[model samples]
Target: MSELNHVPRRPLIAAFLSLCCGPLGQLYAGRGKRSVTLAVVTLVLMIVAAPIALWIPGGHVSFKLLMFAFACWPVFLIVDAFQCARKARQQRLHWYQRWWLYPLVFLAYLGPVSLISELRTVFIAEAFLIPTGSMHPTITPGDRILVNKLGSRDDVIDYGNVVVYYSKGPGSPLYVTRVVALEGDTIEIRDESVFVNGKQISEPYAAFDGELPTYPNMVSMQPVVVPPRHFFALSDSRRRSMDSRMLGPVPIDYFQGVASRIFWSRPRQIDFSVSPENSQIGAIAWERIGMPIR
Candidate 1:
């Protein structure tokens, strides 16, 4: 046997590569076939599991189980890669084993997985943290909520649904607000009261600090007609919200999804107009946890 074949593979490098890029570690350990197989399996599992998980009824425990399975793919790959590298280091290799085909196989396997992951983020549900009181009363600061990326795609986004959308500028944070008006609807706000299509719409969930009305801003003139493929959103706490009144109507393409539910909530000094001056201990807002956002 050649001297090169007698040398042990570097398990640490393999592990690190796996951590950085899925299945790359297998290639590093000269296991091209294993790397390709693992990558293909991981991608297939993720692609198949995501829609199944999302389709499961939200109330069922199996939904969470499926989601857990989808999320564990990365962990599974990492651990398997580490173990494969460790075992490969223990075994003597033939000179022919370390071939250029390994890296090519790794790249071939990685491309599809990366593409699927990106598509999943765009078309599936994703978690988001509420960092401001812009959507207060419906969503609070420190609350973790799930955004259903497929919500609007599958069904018509109706009035009064809370939606998560992208901001206009590059690198802008996602904004969550209530859909008050849809395409072709006429919207007007008088003395903080919302009127849609010439009728006053009752909003029981709307929060107001006092008798203060919606401030006169750039978009707060006589009835504004919502354009085609656009929506008007407002904060539940209207007095403090910087929503469509300030940002203008949001295009349909900008929408990410509708806010589904509060998965977690922590009691912090929320920046609402009526927040308490001091934070409290054991401050988890238990009532808000698992509360579905309407």
Candidate 2:
């Protein structure tokens, strides 16, 4: 058999390091292009994935595409790190050159979740998982939604608009509710009718069963006074929801922002995983791939 041609140590080292953490080992072996590209990509991905991991509510990625990207990063990092070390020793590169791999490995510990949070939060895009069916038919269980952190408008809170606001106080999960009434509007509920400003507020979005008030307190619009800068809210699923009825009206300060859209929707299984590792961004419903929120 013919002898295989000899490959250079530098190329071998670069290839190996790139696998562990991308071109890092090759840089130690004195390859500029190889090292820089790996570093840049790793940093870019770390920045992107970190935020998604941090605040994408329940620590799950709302966007399937993003989660897919996040899952592959660490594998690349470990492979590249290994390759870089191999090349340096073979090529007899200087000590400091090989040491760069140490910090790069430390970065691997930062994990994809942390990196996504740090980078995405800088851009003001926050996302969280929908944990309940209160906003059903609009937002379902296990749906991931994108929230505009700085897009909340107080005086502009219009009726029938679905909003994410603090329904419980400073220490509760931000809820998604439809605005039913504005300040001093004389809101009232009876049987299944809603009267505001001495006129009924039209609620087509409210579920039929939810069309009426199901206040846990059974106050039935107990002649409540909605303070200024406060807005009355209700669950879209009226009969099944517990909103301003039980908790009272939500204040402008309690308003977080509007529910923008459903970024990703999956089957109703909290913390669900299809596979053993559940590492991959598995099958998604084709009809809802990019369906916009109403």
Number of the top-ranking candidate, with lDDT as the measure: 1
lDDT of 2 at 293: 53
Candidate 2: TM-score? 0.62
lDDT score, candidate 1, position 86? 79
Model 1 over residues 143-175: C-alpha lDDT tens digits?
888777775542646788898877784367778
Residue pairs of candidate 1 with colliding backbone atoms: none
Off by over 4 Å in 1: 1-17, 25-32, 45-55, 60-67, 82-90, 94-110, 121-129, 144-155, 166-174, 210-214, 217-224, 246-248, 253-256, 260-268, 271-292
Question: How much is the lDDT of residue 157 in candidate 1?
Answer: 69
lDDT of 2: 0.61
Clashes of each: 0, 25
Give the poorly placed runs of model 2, Cα more than 4 Å off: 1-100, 108-123, 152-156, 209-223, 269-284
lDDT scores for all predictions? Answer: 0.73, 0.61
